[model samples]
Target: MRLIIAIVSAISRGLGVIAALCLLSAVLSVSEMVFVRYVLGHSTIWQTEFTTYAIVAATFLGAPWVLIQRGHVNVDILQLAAGPRLRIAMEVLAALFSLLFVGLLAYAGWVHYEEAWSNNWTSETVWAVPLWMPLLPMPVGTIMLALQYVAEIMRLFVEPDAEDGASRNTLFSDTAEGTRP
Candidate 1:
């Protein structure tokens, strides 16, 4: 369990770095676009497409890191009244649901990738990037996210209350009263 948690932690950190790099790519691409349009009096064909791909990559790649950091938006109103045991249960259930959702998404993405591969899909642009290039990231990101969440659920079971500050919420509720069911 400890080994799994450590691996998850490492993967999460790696994703964070990748997300940062993606953001940098977006910024650079946008800057180049601006420079070309203003200074060169012409638009670069690849700037917008490259930036869009970077944005998508950053968004997906950052998910597991965001989960690890508890950085994603959340409503934690009900956490005040929740007991530790209840919190653990909720965490496990949430992780399970997340796994299912991402699992389905990854499966669908794999199918899409296969179709694109068979068709020899390529972007219809000056860049002409291969469609499979971006498609590959979807399942990879989803699997990483699923692994991180699974590790989180397992950590809850193996070492309950080991890291209090690691948890973002005790239950999934919009208000302070917490989840009733």
Candidate 2:
């Protein structure tokens, strides 16, 4: 169990790096597209499409990393107000619900990816990029997210006070004084 959790966390971090690369590539693609379209006075072909796909990939692929890091925005009014046991219960329920929804979403994404690959589907545009190239991230990333959820659940049961800084008895202790310019 410990080994599995470590592996999943490492994989999520690696995917985060991949997601950053996707964003970088998207930025570069857009820059090159602009140069070709305006500076060089030429029509663009694939850059726009590639940028869109890269961004989508980044969003899907980066999710697991976000989950592991607990870097997402939090609305902890209720959590802060709840008793310790209730707080854990709420978190478990939330994780379970998220796991179920993401599991179903991953399944749907897999079906779409399979269909695209099997049918040799391509974009209607002149570039005619294969649809599976973009669709693959949807299932792959969602599955990773599901695995992260499982690891989270395991960790929660094993160390009930670990998540969201609950061990410290406050989710946002450092930010107790609101940030303001």
Clashes of each: 1, 0
| Model 2, residue pairs in steric clash | none
* TM-score of each predicted structure versus truth: 0.84, 0.86
Cα lDDT tens digits for candidate 2, 1-181: 7678889989999999999999999999999999999999999999999999999999889999999888766677897788655666777788899899999999999999999999999999999999999999999999999999998877765543544443432232343322221
Q: For residues 16-72, could you state the per-residue lDDT of candidate 1 as single tens digits?
A: 799889999999999989999999999689999989888888887888888888786
The per-residue C-alpha lDDT of model 1 at residue 60 equals 78
Candidate 1, residue 94: lDDT: 68
- The superposed Cα distance between candidate 1 and the true structure at residue 169, in angstroms, equals 17
After TM-score superposition, the amount by which residue 131's alpha carbon in candidate 2 deviates from its true location, in angstroms, is 0.6
| Most accurate candidate by TM-score | 2
Alpha-carbon lDDT, every model:
0.78, 0.86
